[model samples]
Target: MTSLSSEMSEPGANPLDTVERLALANDWAFHRQSDDELAAEIAGQWCNYKLWFSWHPELGVMQLSCALDIKVPAKKREKSYTLLALANEKLWVGHFDIWSEEAVPVFRHALLFRDGNNASIELMEDLIDIAVTECERFYPAFQFVFWGGKEPHEAIVAAMLETEGEA
Candidate 1:
């Protein structure tokens, strides 16, 4: 992990610039696709996450999608959708959704920088951290539903179970 600056970006600055800096600082695999787009791959405990950041300068909104490496098969899509709904209910910041075209689950969030307000580096860091953390936390539920043949609710319960102490 890389240490992020505590500074806030200047108003009217493209947020993707900050994102690019963060990606470089962390040594994550990344590409600056355009002035408004950035894509990065981050390795997590459960899987590698594909992160896409899109900056809409006109709207002053930056959208991020952190996608899991696994794809939900057609037969498992219904259950996966259910699991996504249940998982999203637990999140305070972002929500998980299955990208219909890709059949991949992604954690999505957006930050608004309209009205000349600045975006803090801490906020950007938190956005990435939260997305990865949520994805890691819920990965097993998807696995259980897809591969373990468990029901969505059951998978959620099983994945969310926490042991009391270290062995």
Candidate 2:
């Protein structure tokens, strides 16, 4: 099997710089906690999302997690897990997860930049776009399961339906 390190190259750049610039360009409220960490808040149709970015220079990886505003109660945790599993299955990149400490759901993904590969503004934009879109697509499912008393499968079905045109 080919090793990941072999496929990758040496890294020395920090991706948080790019992320900070992207956050500012969009006029989003953001904080640069440190050279390696940044946080931003974005408004969506359903609710606001908290985006956190961490850059690992040694590992040559940048990780992003976008947390939804909704929270999962202890009683609804099981159903939320099931819903997350179903939602993650439909995604090509990133996965949905419950942040246990905060009991909030988040979409997480990572980018590997090796051999002098740097993150472009377009790439950062796409990363944020995809995360928010996926969260919006499934926000109702979480609500359905927690408050509407719908089963995970049923909620998934309802949330996944696409309307072709406006009435």
Candidate 3:
């Protein structure tokens, strides 16, 4: 059955609503946290992460934030910082960083529309896709740094290496 996914992709559609519909169609769990925000927990290949999206219609800007919840050991904080810096350099759309107060690393990206116009659903979907895909791709590097005692450069190289497998 053809879903309303195409219709929802039209410009001027509410990005948040589009996300909600897509999430349901994909059987993913999500919650509408507010008129302008939605939270989704995605179970990924390596691990799970909670993604929170905030959209400001007036400004036509959206921010997607995901908390990896992998705390950097106090002793390894410098390595964590180094890893993040290296990882971010390879990223074109989004970047990863540690939340200093909590020692939790977060992946964040922002989208801005020209002249305060609403974003098309396709753009919204693309934003979410990048967030999840990048997180899944590089999560293990964080693990290696925090747990496996791997050096930052080595961990990033391991993360950036493409593996052939079924998705």
Best by TM-score: 1
Q: What is the TM-score of each candidate against the true structure?
A: 0.96, 0.91, 0.84
Comparing 1 with 2 on lDDT, the higher-scoring candidate is: 1
For 1-167, candidate 3 gives per-residue lDDT tens digits of: 11434453445445787778767876777999897999988788877788888988777777889878577899998888899899899899889978778888889997775443555456666777788888887888999999998999999988888769988
Ranking by lDDT: 1, 2, 3
Model 3 misplacement above 4 A: 1-4, 8-13, 164-167
What's the C-alpha lDDT at position 14 in model 3? 54
Models ranked on TM-score: 1, 2, 3
Local accuracy of candidate 1 as per-residue lDDT tens digits, 1-167 = 68775887888999999888888999999999999999999999999999999999989999999999999989998888899889988899989998888999999999999887776777788889999999999999999999999999999999899889899
Clashing pairs in 2: none
lDDT of 2 by residue, 60-142 (tens): 89999999998897899998989999999999999999998999999999999877787766677778899999999999999
Q: How many Å off is the CA of 85 in candidate 1?
A: 1.2
Worst 10-residue lDDT window, candidate 3: 1-10
| Root-mean-square deviation of every model | 1.1, 6.6, 3.0
Error in Å for residue 87 of model 1: 0.8
Q: For candidate 1, give the lDDT.
A: 0.91
Candidate 3, overall lDDT? 0.79
- Superposed model 1: Cα runs more than 4 Å off: none
